[model samples]
Target chain A: MSRTIAVVAAGAMGAAVGARLAARGARVVTSLDGRSEASIVRARAAGMIGVGDAELAGAEIFLSIVPPDKAVGLATRMAAAIAAARTRPVYVDLNAVSPATAREVGAIVAAAGATFVDGGIFGAPPQREGKGPAFHLCGPVGDCAAILAGHGLDAKVLEGGVGAASALKMAYAGITKGLTALGAGMILAATRHGVGGALLDELGASQPELLARLAKGIPDMLPKAYRWVPEMREIAATIGEDRPESAVYTAMAEFYAAVAADHAGEERETALLMRFFAGRG
Target chain B: MSRTIAVVAAGAMGAAVGARLAARGARVVTSLDGRSEASIVRARAAGMIGVGDAELAGAEIFLSIVPPDKAVGLATRMAAAIAAARTRPVYVDLNAVSPATAREVGAIVAAAGATFVDGGIFGAPPQREGKGPAFHLCGPVGDCAAILAGHGLDAKVLEGGVGAASALKMAYAGITKGLTALGAGMILAATRHGVGGALLDELGASQPELLARLAKGIPDMLPKAYRWVPEMREIAATIGEDRPESAVYTAMAEFYAAVAADHAGEERETALLMRFFAGRG
Candidate 1:
């Protein structure tokens, strides 16, 4: 008997994950009520079955994969549907968020009489050929990893109850994405001061690996700058408002917001960054 | 002919550099004015000759190697002494400061009828048996590099004028030190949340290089955190007041200030960081 799983709003990551589960003999159902045509096409191509929001609660597992800002709203929606259904599925939140936000969602799921599993995904989306991303599960995961692994997903259960996975996620992304923002900012400032070449030369002679990481990261970050805005805010929240390190994430939020605006507008700054890494990369 | 170079108020870097010059047969002079006993001992051990403030102006080259906060004060004092002297030696501002600050020092030296060279140091202090730090010089640095190289220093001339070298220094330090602060903050936050062990495990599996860097950098940064406070501020100023990236340096300044305070006060936070990297390092 193929167990049914509800993967919400077929975005890039959601659709890819849905495809992987579907390919491994699982019935993947998704609610695409307000999704775009591109999302609809992705869903169909990924072999996901589209159904109404209420029908989504009938599945054995509900995977909430959405933007950081949308995590709460999706949880609220799923709670209502799960409360009305006879068989409530386990709700798994896999969005990149702070630990505090994870606990807030956990509370909502508990109120709906559904088992909640806190999860965070590391690495890129699953591909047809390559190593798949790891799904770090926390809280009362029970047999969640076994179920996820049965569907060809890489799932690892971490110690501690809720927020462990999110904390790891926040810390990891804080370093990686935080570095990208810092590199882009300083490189632009150096270029503005006409010592950009010298800075690069110094970095090559000193920290070559860091320079190489920036070359690859800054270019890769261009298209995804918009998505990182709220995510950085989430990281700030994870670090707590009382700490000085929290301010770094807040500043990074403002930086990504500016980059997103620049990427959407004339792309002047974006072009400068692309050119900086063009020959070097 | 052996050049008489005045290296002011011999601190660690100043004393080491003075020793290198003295060993290469240059006459190294310094002022003992209000320095601590430790500084006096270091200066004497490094073969530097103690002289009065007015006598320092008689040297062929004046190297201002002090803390970032003391750069302007030293330059002002040098300008006065240069104005009263018969022969105005070339004044090199070698402190970590913003481009604007460098230009300000340049103007002050020029008004006193002394040639000014804007310079910044990269790498650690020169040792007896290892690679020496590079001295980057800008402005009208005529035979300054040749003179410094003759005394066993690695002197490189940069293009443009007064602010060029300072700009390079600011950009380089901004990245290296900025990353260290970000790592320390996030690791502490994770530890506070009880997910620190998992965070390290994940980092070891994913970003092993960054983990290695933090393990070394955090411990090394303990004692030097006090010196980095003003340097981080200079980096913030170098990025200009209007940019979002400037905020990062401001936040980093606060972070280092806190670390310095913590290190001075209770051994609580400092011990936590030390233990975090103890066996892993």
Candidate 2:
């Protein structure tokens, strides 16, 4: 039997996940309003169908991928939608929000007599045709593993209820992305001194492996950093409830957001950042 | 014939270097006035002979290892001593001073017709017997390699003249010691936020190797960082001449000096810094 998968507030990642499921012959329905034109175009390009509230009345699985700041509000609206539905769908709050928010969303879905699963995506949306990144899912969904596996989505179930998945995401992003920022800063400082070459030579001499990794890693990641800023903020806010010290990522989000905003006016900011990372600026 | 080695302004490192040569059977003479009691005791324990200007007249090698602030003054005094010596000696300036100051010392030695070698010690003085660290030397003196080899010191002769050795030292220290300061700040911030445990757990889970190195490195180095602050300042001054942007290290020196000052009165600062590094603060 075909399963109905409803993706709320469909954006790049939401569209990607929906398209991947739809391609596998599942009924993938995405909420159409309150999204950017780019998001709508991306959803259409990814083969996800935009549906009204009436068309989403029979969804068997509800996957919420709205912005983290709007996670609770979306959950409230989705709870009302599910209440009016002919059948209650299993609610999976996949938004990058704190455990407190997730728990509130869980309560909303539970009050509507629907099952809740907490899910967090760990990588970028699948860009090429027919490829998907890791989608880590956790909670007490009776058939989450089988359902996700059947559709070829890599899903892992962790023990700590609503927050563990977000915690893992926050921690991983903090190190990988945080080091990227540090590497960029150092490279810029070196270039400004006109001793970038000398610094790299010394780094190669002393810490060859790390220097090589940093050289390769920094430049390659700069182009995509702008897209990750908001996601990082979402993860930071979600995990910060339990791990308040992760506020560094909140600062990092601001740092990357500034770059992203500047990128909107002059895409050259990313280029400049990359140049600095390569020790050429 | 055995060569005589005279160390001017014998402080901790100067006394150690002189004593190391003496231990290897070189005739070592060190000036003792205005030195700390601990330094004098260390020199006595290491079998270095305390000598006046007349007694240093016959030495074949003169090493200047005074503080950075005293380098020029000591260089002038050593120039007078070298002029009065019966035979010209190879003069090595190993003080942490700007490249310009090093050149000035070089001029002083040249005025006395003595060969000048600019050198920088890369590591701490030997805490135990017969375990001195490496020293990098470069200058007009082509016989520096032979001189150091004869005295059983691990000295590498780099290519550039008076400033290259100091440049290399500054660049290397900038990364290693700069990272040390950064890690110190991050760990302190983490502990202050009451999520030190979580940060440690995350670091262990994500970057075990780096965290392990930081754990071992920070605590062992913090107590000794006070001594390195002035050396860092000297290196900054040297590198900042050709590269005025190396002022970062001067700032770092001030930061380390502040940390040292804070730790001097309160045992808690050192203990807290160590705990933060070990991820248990």
lDDT of 1 by residue, B40-60 (tens): 999999999999867898788
- In lDDT terms, how accurate is model 2? 0.66
Model 1 Cα lDDT, one tens digit per residue, A161-215: 8998888888888888899998888888888888888888888887888999898
Query: Which lDDT value does model 1 have at B237?
Result: 95
Q: What share of the true interface contacts does each candidate keep?
A: 0.67, 0.03
Worst 10 residues of 1 chain B by lDDT: B272-281
Candidate 2 residue-wise lDDT, B1-281, digit = tens: 66788887667777778777887788888877777798789788877888887567558877777766677787777777778877978778776666667788889878977888887666667554654666767777677667777787877676567765555555556556665654554565444434456556556754676677668767766776786688667655654434322444555576677667767767665777777665565
List the TM values for chain B, per candidate: 0.95, 0.85
lDDT of 2 by residue, A91-118 (tens): 8887665556678888987897778887
Instruction: Extract clashing residue pairs from model 1.
Output: none
TM-scores for all candidates: the values are: 0.94, 0.61
CA lDDT scores, all candidates in order: 0.88, 0.66
Model 1 chain A weakest lDDT span, ten residues long: A272-281
What lDDT does candidate 1 reach at residue B91?
92
